[model samples]
Target: MCPCGFLLPIHKGETLPSSLTVRRCDLQRFLKVIRGAGLLSRKGIPAWVSLDASSGVLRLRAANTQVEVQLQLEAADSAFEAIVDAEFLKICSGKEASSVTLSLADDEVTASWFDADVPRAARFVLRSSDSVPPAVAAPEILATNEPHLLEALREAQATTDPGASRFALACVQLRSAEGRIAATDSRQLLVQRGYQFPWAGDRLMQITPVFGAQEIDRSQDVQIGEAGNWIAVQAGPWRIAHAVEVEGRFPNVDLVIPSPSSLVSSMSVETGDARFVLERLDKLPCSDTLHEPVTVELNGSVAIRSRQEESAAAVELVLSRTQRNGNECRLQMDRRYLGRALKLGLREVGFTAGGGPCVARDAQRDYVWMGLGQENTISAADVGDRLLSEESVGG
Candidate 1:
């Protein structure tokens, strides 16, 4: 928090702590930086952190260790707070960068990004006609039906690899057939599977975001094609429509997840360690997609028959080591997509991973594993190439 009456100077080129300002440039920078990580960016992030530019109140929030510092913006004329992802700030550093820059020109937005380290920056321009942008509200790490998905995502990978790691995870592709969500980092390769939601009609196929759990959790109105990619999360005072789908092919990343298991068993979230687990995954999200209460089975264990509608979480990413009997299961998915899925749930949930991605349908049958291939070790581009090779073989 800035000093009570401290008169801090925000440099000309530098931006006011975004959480405190509603400057258009500041907002754009916030989104651009957050959107940089090529394939790892969470799709359904909150539009904006609450703030009234008219009221000079500054509320700045950037969290690490599950605890964040909010510099409440306070100005008599126009006060506001800016909520930005701590990770987004890192993208602006230009060191480990695979990001796109979003610039505004009289309400027009253009994106220029470098897909890989060696290549020059490439730009993808979206015309007002080509893009469908909802009004920009307050941006956030993960909002909407919170408390649960955040718990799950954190349980999956609390601390993202400030460095880098590898693994495959479940994924949602709006048009996986066309290629949308993908694990693009060389260190984190992603495999994906297309899922059909109960309301899936003209709505795109997607790997729900970290906030999705919450949206699905609290939503009473689950209309299908009537709603597009926008899911109106009704939790906070204001209802919000978050973007959950990506328009591309989520790589076939199933090669990394262990083969389909007939031995399906139910699991529950940890009890006391819930908060701790969430904090950890929030920081990482780079480790494999292993949620605390995810379904599992022993090497030769019997198939325990079951399904659970509600089972609170104990911890987020207890890791395979935390298992009671050294019995843990590997969740194969598009890491990017899985991280996004568990972004906004309320409490922990019951899950079962058979062989593919079936969105944790209790501990019972063979569900579709979202993706194939290894994550944390390979980039989505490489996986795409390998997929191209496989396609050639079949062709």
Candidate 2:
């Protein structure tokens, strides 16, 4: 068996033999790559695993409809290719063994493992099946800063509506010329800048599979490649390719962001105080996670309370150091939306209070959400009156 030093990529249409053998540790590493690339869709999407000895080392490729990942390892015997349930490799790799052999024959693929130390041998078999076409080759290479890429991916996810019927709303728009990534769920918009992809020019790519972004290694610089409507991300030994949404244009996020002159008053709040209030709200019942109304006042004092009548356990939490420019104002929104922004590791939150859209901005990222309308807003005086009444009743 030849020693495998580094894993190299394998393209489609490679010559393969009938059987191959790999150490248990190498098999486990392959499984980890599969898990990180998010090729195994919860919708039971099957994956294709193929091996090729054309590269001198054993090149293993795994792919589903939306993603494809490739890696190489040392192996004994000839190469083989097979299409099976996406979970097959995971189960095979989990078995207790020192080494595993994979063979293809009789319209089926078999995984055999033996632990000589334990004096036991076991095998699992699954019938081979057909799979979709291979992923497009990503040849154009573009270097990206790790921190910028990760920040854009995470901020865009907060605004993407994965279940949206429209492809644009369900994806993160990568506008290279603008040097920013944007996503909107219609109710809110999040824009993250500082990305430069000069190779893409004015082109826009809508990335649908955002989960792969989480698997990127932070220690290494991220490499991006593009071919047709597909984008590839490669870091170290892991390479993840995803299909970009091509049907629609992402809404212009810049049009909606509040301008400085339009913002009347703004105040900063400690993230710890915000978290404490959110924890109290989480105890109450919420019929709609995305639209459950929660009102916040940044006038003379800071206070938050759930607006749903069904949540009888709701309580108003007044915060410290919430005082602002003496202007009295209140903003009502879904607590879930606020929670998403706060979870971005922001130390403080700044709110733009005026007769304009609800806008929140931190150092690098900006958050915007629509209010629940006048019918849902409770005046500051009314809140004070209600709190005093509750205290009297308790006494």
Candidate 3:
């Protein structure tokens, strides 16, 4: 018997005819796809794996008051509808087998696996309350063949709020008029634009940053659709739907973004050097009270400095081209947040200072704007003079 009280009918020498049967390989493939869709729930409300033989599709669905994931797989054969614990069916499919047969008799559903050397089988008695979830209506098609949609979602994921206080910042917002996707966690904002999609209206949906990372094949074209309160994505054979919640408004991120003309000092650094500096800064003790601000000084060259309670460190790099507007500028910002932009692996990263927020981006449209710290406006000359005075005193 399975852990969920699924009886092994074949072990009892019963010969119940199967109403639906398919190859073991096909069933395994379906399980893998649904598992990657983030629909395999094990606790709280029971996770159900429902088979609709009438429609020739299998489904795994789980929902809470805030989130819902419904994944469907094509090519399932069954005579009647059967719903069982998702984990139980996954285990049954995991057995060594060449083919698997499913039998629906009364409220009990039997799963039997056949192999060249041995045959194994298990049966799950459905509860009276167990029923298949109603199918979601087909959503309106928004965009297709857009590769940057996933990229934008990935970048926005870095800025989404994981806590419950700011409910709206936890979702990625798609703006139809601007053709962009954006997200923010109050401290940082990431926006990706230039998506060639025929969007009819704006849509906001809550989706995990990790969604579609493992489920969708990069080579296949992708489609985005919306209906009711859900957004559906179909990439190749993989499909994912996210239920929308929390209708709160996203902050006006454009107000925080500094214009390029307003920058006092701008510099460009190799991607490798930028990543190295950020990684080294990450090792230093960070200040929780002020969010570990890393100071960048641009004069003749570039210098990155950070201090954690009296332990101070600095890294100097000559691998940059600088444009100074008759004044050396220094900007302080959160090191970790800044690192997220630098790690994007762009060939060259453009950094702008003396702005409301520090801006970093590549040649393309990808960009990240990080909040400036309280003591953000120190001049590079002032920092140099202070360091010299301190060294003289120590001497």
Candidate 4:
């Protein structure tokens, strides 16, 4: 016989030819019985969907009685349907079934397949398959968005695994509508709210998981479904098993947004905005075009610099060109964290230059506000030398 266990031998004896096949009627009847009666042991070793290959029929013994389910593979329009029984399909739907190990001790079901391995014959412990994670349930949905916002969010990496937890947890205080979606993390925040206010909710903010942001890169449906206590998220080919929402309220975020800046009337051109925080930092002072980002920009009229008297190198976000008449502003941030916000996006941008408060307005709506943050300038021999060498000196 071949290595696959097919019957192959010298043409002799009373054995039938290898070309013979099982009958159609018999195959159908066996499948019907399994579909109706057999108790599927999903956690059993050599766990097969149809009847066991070695055992001609599947058997479930209870007390003094025994029930058998017969099954065989053959051609028929409904051949596979008999295999899709309620309990069987449910088992297959789980994350992935590693070697199913049935825990039958003295002939009784006990631990999950991943758990206890019972003794077989005289010795030899079997494989584990006992711990079955609770079935996944979808989160309690707070808001829903149209396909457009979903698409744009994908471009920014919102639906992947990294972003799932963040997106799911940030469900509170959300504004659900048809335009955009936004979330934040432990460090910074975001506000991609409105069509004319494309974002939904009282404020534009988020706290999404890192995997979700990665999912955003892949444009696909992100449907959340839950049954009983299990939470499930279907994004592209990935299915996220999320825990049920714990009882609690998300923190308030509106207190953090900075005020908006008036458009400089005199300045004809200005730039500097990145898709994410890193890009924003990169464009901080490369050149004119480098500084100008159509969606968001950082332009100041005065140069602000700070260096410490003790140690630590001083850094600043200078407002290079003030053609439109504005104060110079410096925004120093951890390059990495800044990049994360850029990916989430903003509704409007504001500038804080000349030590004066800056503003960020909701361009899609009438919402506008001011923000207060702190950082000390590195004290140098004087502010003059610091100003001259700063990146904002020219534009």
Candidate 5:
């Protein structure tokens, strides 16, 4: 007898021949992984969904041409197998039942459960497949206890240009020897350091797995490995495998960043104040795209304003710290690129003035972007600078 007041039709010690009882929580957990891998929708690029249980282990697999995600759970001793539509799992996992028993037939799957002592059943058509979803077999494994691997992947992935003609620009380059992950779209670049991995190759890993990695619990150790042209990561009971770019070579990003000695001026600001400025500019009547140029005036204080030709708006914020070898500097940067850097959750942002690419650094990572030209002069009489008190902003 179960807690729902419904007895599963099995003797005290005998298991159901063809059904497996799974907790609703487990089903929801795997569904999150499926959604993270960009497979939850039935739109373009269909994902194959397969479930199998044997030897007290239950496995759920979802795969597309770009990525594959699998989740494992412990189950009672029984043999069960089924291939169903991703939507079917979505519906079954959304029910309010505490636990559901899944029974597989030749062409259908039956989900039976108890709803407040009332029995309920739903039938879903099974998908026909000659074979189950294929798995990537990687013989090599680079297991690391690195706590920030996921954080680095997410930060670098944002800089990738998915539509770039150069395929390498659409992937994140792993610098195992230097313990760094870097990505660039020719317009902007982001590099995160302080990672220790055993990978010896210079292959470019696709960014698709970064989506799947977000679904994994951060407390688990993520194991990364490469096999030929594929890269895989295992975190807790979830495993993600992705194909890598086999032919293209990632460009050397270190050449674009300016050296410390070449920096002319450096200004620092509290992250909270910077975010407030960005959010205010975003609310202006500007293009929905992040392409709008925002000017940064770096001197004793930091000032930001949108460069929309027809609108005049300005906000001057007190700098938390500053150091400069020359006069004040001003540069026009894409609003979107600056926002991406702030997403890394760094407490402070250091804007460096140089002759080359624009550079922004935090305690852990470096961000560089190109095509930063001088902005038109904005005088105090045109749009008075609203000086914000330091006590008004919270970090």
Candidate 6:
């Protein structure tokens, strides 16, 4: 066997009978995806960048006990497998060359590049090791476009708490059969529906940390599959498989969202104004006991106020419209959390405040609900009484 663990053996110091040619730009793009997968190690170890000459695939892989990321590029030629260090390949990709040629010879992998302007040729020779990376099995699941999955994941991730008491709250849950995805951090809940996938059977998959959303190429579609304890995400030439964390029983977050009929007062505001107010409020002084709470008071017009110590700030936004059953409403919630929900870029944002949770939804049905805050909670009756007292004084 060859030193690189290939079935074929090449004589000492002899050039192996396999070579592959790839454009520099394509190789750089493939490496960029691999870097995003969190696989490249800065340490000078053999990070194991592999080339399969027969299948025309170049692969870079890094894995821990729980998760594994494999990035492949189909730009190889001939029939042999060789392993080289990731740092060597990264340096070769950085050279000012239009094309890169890789060849396996004896126990070494040679990478050669020539610049169009310069007469000199730059070449790197890396000793191949016997270590071979394990093959990543492709699971039989469903595939969807990257944009749809990414959008849902981003919204869900916004509400997921990394340090939550319940493990499931830290993960983004994808229920393919139900056509919905949901996530929450106890204080807030976000659920998005209307996703169509080909796969059947009610399979519940939980993605921890939501790293796939950051790693996946937005321009490509994603192939999703679950096998045993792992969920595989194949986006373009990269495949990432993460172990499903033991979440036990996920909480019933759907119950927290108040129905439209239960709302006492509802108000609509321009998305731009809502976002601007929230951003400004985020800069105010806040404490653990008193998170900068934005109070949304619904009268004839909508007013938002936040106060800390002796400092107070308020912004009045014209309500596009409002609905009430002869009752006033006031809601206070953490301004930072509200800012994240509003930044989803919905043209118009709808807010519903009452005795139940304060719910905000966009035109796309993407809703965020904030439960009663520990420091800031006001009842609808109290709000109505205060408004009546003010009106009586004016009269």
Best by TM-score: 5
Answer with 3 or 4, whichever has the higher TM-score: 3
Per-residue lDDT for 144-251 in model 4, tens only? 323344344332233222333434334423344533333334334444555222222433222123232332214654454343433333444333332323443444
Q: State each candidate's clash count.
A: 102, 0, 0, 84, 0, 0
Candidate 2, 1-395: lDDT as tens digits: 11111222322333224666666666566676676556556465545456555434676677765667766555554445555554556655643446555566565555555444332223333434444566458557665666457556656766778677754676777767666677888888887766666365544444444333444466767677776667776666566666676666667788888776656555565655655654555664454566777776666667666644542444566666444543566777677666766666543444455333666776566787766643555555444223321223221
List ranges where model 4 is wrong by over 4 Å: 1-130, 137-187, 194-219, 225-231, 258-348, 351-375, 378-395
lDDT for each residue of candidate 3 in 27-125, tens digit (9 for 90 to 100): 565566555444565355555666655567655444433334444555445556666766655656643445566787776777776545466766676
The TM-score of candidate 6 is 0.70
> Candidate 1: lDDT over CA atoms?
0.29
Pick the lDDT winner.
5
Using lDDT as the yardstick, the better of models 5 and 6 is: 5
Q: How many Å off is the CA of 388 in candidate 6? A: 25
Q: Kindly give the stretch of ten consecutive residues in candidate 4 with the minimal lDDT sum.
A: 59-68
Could you tell me the lDDT of residue 96 within candidate 4?
A: 29
**What would the per-residue lDDT of candidate 6 be over residues 178-295, giving only the tens digit for each residue?**
6677787787777777664445544334444334344456676666777666767767766777666654456776677766666666655454455445445566444334555666
Q: Candidates' TM-scores? A: 0.26, 0.75, 0.76, 0.39, 0.84, 0.70
Assess each prediction's global lDDT (C-alpha) against the native: 0.29, 0.59, 0.58, 0.31, 0.66, 0.55
As a whole number from 0 to 100, the lDDT of residue 250 in candidate 3 is 74
Off by over 4 Å in 5: 1-16, 41-45, 95-97, 115-118, 125-133, 209-214, 271-281, 284-290, 307-313, 320-326, 346-356, 389-395
The candidate, 4 or 6, that scores higher on TM-score is: 6
Worst 10 residues of 1 by lDDT: 382-391
Regions of model 6 farther than 4 Å from truth: 1-17, 41-48, 57-61, 95-97, 105-108, 114-133, 141-146, 197-222, 271-290, 311-326, 346-356, 362-366, 371-395
Ranking by lDDT: 5, 2, 3, 6, 4, 1
Q: Which stretches of candidate 3 lie above 4 Å from their native place? A: 1-16, 19-43, 54-80, 93-100, 114-120, 127-133, 140-142, 162-167, 196-199, 210-212, 278-281, 284-290, 311-327, 346-355, 362-366, 372-395
lDDT of 2: 0.59
Which stretches in model 1 have alpha-carbon errors above 4 Å? 1-52, 55-76, 79-146, 151-229, 232-395
lDDT of 1 by residue, 1-395 (tens): 21111122222333222222223334333333223212223355322222234454433232221111122323445433222223333322243323323333333222233324332221222223212223323333322222332233223232222223232223222222422223322223323223222332322222223332322233332212113434332332223233443443334434433342532332333322333333333443222334312222222321111112223212123222112222444333443333333332212222244334323222211122243322222212222111111122221
lDDT (Cα) of model 4: 0.31
